[model samples]
Target: MSDARAQAPETEIVDRNLTLEIARITERAAIAAAGWRGKGDEMRADQAAVEAMHDALTRIDFKGKVVIGEMRGSEKLGLDEEVGTGRGPDIDVAVDPLEGVTGCAKDLPDALSVLAFAERGGLLHVPDAYMEKIAIGPGYPEGIVDLDKSPRENIETLAKAKGVPITEIVACVLDRPRHASLLAELREIGVAVKLLPDGDIAAVIHAANSDDTGIDIYMGSGGAPEGVLAAVAMRCIGGQMQGRLILDTAAKREQAERIGIPDLKAKYSAEDMAHGDVLFAATGVTKGSLLNGVKILPRKIVTSSVVMRSWSKTTRWITAEHQR
Candidate 1:
């Protein structure tokens, strides 16, 4: 099939205007979360972001369906919710209104408001669960890293492919108890490991642009929705990523089935998760490795956002100053 037919019935669904509109959506969520920064209340901060994002989404000129969203039952953007104005082509949307609630509450780095857009049935219907992910930046061999490979073996292969020593490669992993063994293994292999408090989406995106972000690889399990979001960005940037959902409970397995996932042990590649002309947008809610934090002044709010399109291979950095 041709690229256009594989992606959508109409080629104009994800034009530049729609890309910028998605950035605005993320910007609103970032500004709202920025207000709640350092308040030590994660719930309130997340609520602010969700409300702001949903409001912004409702104004967009498209028919959007939320395939992946908040896992918690109380969040505003629920799974399967229909957003957007009733005046545009039908599309799929996956969102994380507030990706790092803990980071926002504690004023830590790497909190972000993120979302991805694709034509209907273009994005994987990933259920809310833990996902094991490993990613690398662009320009590497297609199978340089694999989820089935041990961390030591993956790093050794990546270092050889990059023409760098094992000691020079920097791996990014989430700072959680579950990663204790993973971190230790990386360190034992003489690979430098950077631990992040929250936000694996930023970590993986950093890995996608190691020259700028200083992250050569990202490994560990995080929210499955964020994994899908990261896959979207990786697709736009010409990177590699693989993920496998951990359906440890019967309920989780049942949930995956409801979302149309047939195989409980299925592994996902970047293209498998988000295929054919994807648009991804993210705004930094706090100071982070990938993006700058939102700046609020007396009368204006400044936000840094990155918008990407896979078909055009276009990555645009936008700084918008909004008058309050």
Candidate 2:
């Protein structure tokens, strides 16, 4: 099995704050996507975000390779595509231009624009596939949870580790049909399950930011690219996560093999997904837990964003008022 942790990033660059620049990118995307909110067009909203994010990224000076991006179908920012103006450090980029298309279209909560920056090979490049993920916030003993464990066991163990009852723990999960049995198991164990309509990346962040949200863990399957993006945030915000690609089909397995992931069943740690110096930025497209969505005013637009840097363990909440 190939480990992505080996090619970790070096010390931070002194030139500029990359996290803030990336925040602008997400801000642009969120603003663009917000224009279509509640218009009931998912693809149009996604396209608006993708185009704006691509334009913002290309205008930047860094040399970036899209390690994790919109898979096969999207017109821009596909895997392995080179971006930026090619004038600065060589880095890996992972992005989800619009995280919750459905939510955004319906004017629901937590629609976001997100991306991560890491050193070359600092991110695990996986094919477009579903990933089985398990995550928890910081301050826990290593190896306390595993993907192979049932929800009951994981929740009970986490509750005990925290010296609390199972009812006190809250686990976030996608409200999908596939999770029916898992939901039943969690309910039987008395752990509250927070059902998310979309945005598993936010779900992971919620789990990582347990002090504020009380989300003890996040489990279930989501996009492999989003898994990498979430892992980057964990590196900065402090968390533990594990993911395994669900390459059940022959085509998916072959694609994984082609991308150097020979061990189809190999479980990857958060560090394995993003091991080096990294930055993560996210801007809300709709009002949600982590941030307030873009607000359009008569004379300006306001955006709320969170930017994090791994080396310094700094997390900043930025609010920008752009003249209209």
Candidate 3:
């Protein structure tokens, strides 16, 4: 009799292996970045994370390309930098080695090392800019919230969907002058707001896990690269997100056009940015909303991570102890 399990396709096995391997990639970056916590040198902490992540990536067994990454002018792991052992499935990699360098430097919260991978061309090739984003977690009416809707309207609609009052709905936004109007509008509607200094990716994921995070929605503009990473996480968490690029200048528009983005005002949904089977991994550099920061002990380092696969709808929280 033929063994049914043996007949499974090679790509399936590759994907499963890739999911586990990607977690380790984020883990290495997190551990390395944790070493520089509270050093008050954001550049040095970020560089450490980038170098550690790049080296770990090169050791993975696959043909991986950095489609979305740090700026090209960077000294290490810039855009289009190829990693891996130069073998296995071809994949597109989106990475943010240190999502909150300032937070890490000051020993604040919500710093992380994050990355997303998909089969070649599965991830969006978005140029680094700003993205006007709005997101909500799983289990709601289709289109309960939207990027085109007003802040007040989305809050009202979400409240109605969740059987709660508008004032009880909590929204998360970055604490910045640019979001002053956004915060004012949400507050006007009596929506509770949680403002963080940085880490939009973690904020979006929190909004997606409302039951655990107590954050019902996330809105406002953030980095385009981080937007893609958040989209991938939402895909795994069964959430919804919409983003429109904030290409305000000619140079930014030109950069988008050069990247084959003909539509300047193109709106990208979570799935649109990270379509098909995908894997998302993140490890906290500092205590955070979603995962705990790396805890360095005398004999070993403890790291917390989350690895998710959209195809399988699998999300794993890994607690690993590594000997120093």
Candidate 4:
């Protein structure tokens, strides 16, 4: 099989040992966000995480460029911000200092601090826009669920592929007004649906680990940056996914073009979004299915994080305690 990523220079590979460093960065971001959780202030919580992550990034050895980070106009981790000592291998990075801002602000579940590192030109440069996404765990035939297919068709196809009844297959979607019709169609098909208030990145990870998470599929629209991050994780963790940016407005289209995205209507596969070897790390700001929330103890803070490496096909869960 041909990989689109081969076109990019693959001469230098980011050292696999840096996975722990990446986990530390996310842990710092998560612990920082945890302080503001339930404070009912989204911006402050996100900014705190960004600052903490940025500070942690400076302590690392490798040079990194943010391909995806921060929302536009925030300057948090804006599209081209460079970090690190600029002494190690140059790499591409995608980060979400705080994924579930609203959830974190309200003390809800599933808020996470996530980041991915890849060899130079390894990850796609996605605009900060909405992306139509569909993903499913491994062990099924390729192309079981497609972004172009209707919800019912996707459900039926997946059911047939899994050799189960339609009602037995589970689907996860983001909860939003725009999904009103999508929700209706899924219910109309008699399939089980799990609606997440925020953090579709976790939902996508759950889908990729169906045997354990019990989420057979993930479908819906989410941030393009998170979509690319999820695709990078899927590369390391194992899954199939497809995404297409929702370039609805002129500003979005222009931004996409400015970022060298020539085909506005192109559908990107997991490998297309993040190709070759990559490492992904994510820490839980609030407890959820994927990881435990940051725990503030008497004189220390405990954090849980998961780091994955594509080259080795291994996942590492790290827990650290930091003194106050």
Give the Cα lDDT of each candidate. Answer: 0.90, 0.90, 0.89, 0.89
TM-score of 1: 0.95
* Candidate 1 CA-lDDT value: 0.90
TM value for model 4: 0.95
Per residue, candidate 1 scores C-alpha lDDT tens digits across 1-324 of 677647764355555368888999999999999999999999989988889999998988888899887765555678889999877888899989899999999999999999899988889887778999999998888898999999989999999999999999999999999999998899998998889999988998889899997889999999888989999999999889999999999999998998789888988999999997789999999988778999999999999999998877789999899998
- Estimated TM-score for each candidate: 0.95, 0.95, 0.95, 0.95
Clashes by residue pair, model 4: none
What TM value does model 2 have?
A: 0.95
User: Once superposed on the true structure, which residue ranges of model 1 sit more than 4 Å away at CA?
Assistant: 1-10
lDDT of candidate 3 over 9-126, digit per residue (tens):
5454265489889999999999999999999998878888898999999998888889988753456677888888987788889999999888999999899999889888888888
lDDT of 2 at 324: 96
Q: In model 4, which runs have C-alpha deviations exceeding 4 angstroms?
A: 1-16
Top lDDT hit: 2
Cα lDDT of model 4 by residue, 245-320, tens digit = 9999999999999999989999999999998789899999999889999999999999999999887678998889
Q: Which has the better lDDT: candidate 2, or candidate 3? A: 2
- lDDT for 156 (candidate 3): 93
RMSD of each: 2.6, 4.1, 2.9, 3.3
lDDT per residue for candidate 2 within 1-324, as digits (tens), equals 135544554454335457678989999999999999999999999999999999999988888999898753778998888999998888899989999899999998889999899877799989989999999999999989999888788888898899999899999999899889989888887888999998999999999999999899999999998999999999999979999999989999999999999688999998999987888999999999889999999999999999998877789999999999
Q: Please list the residue runs of candidate 3 whose C-alpha ends up more than 4 Å from where it truly belongs after superposition.
A: 1-16
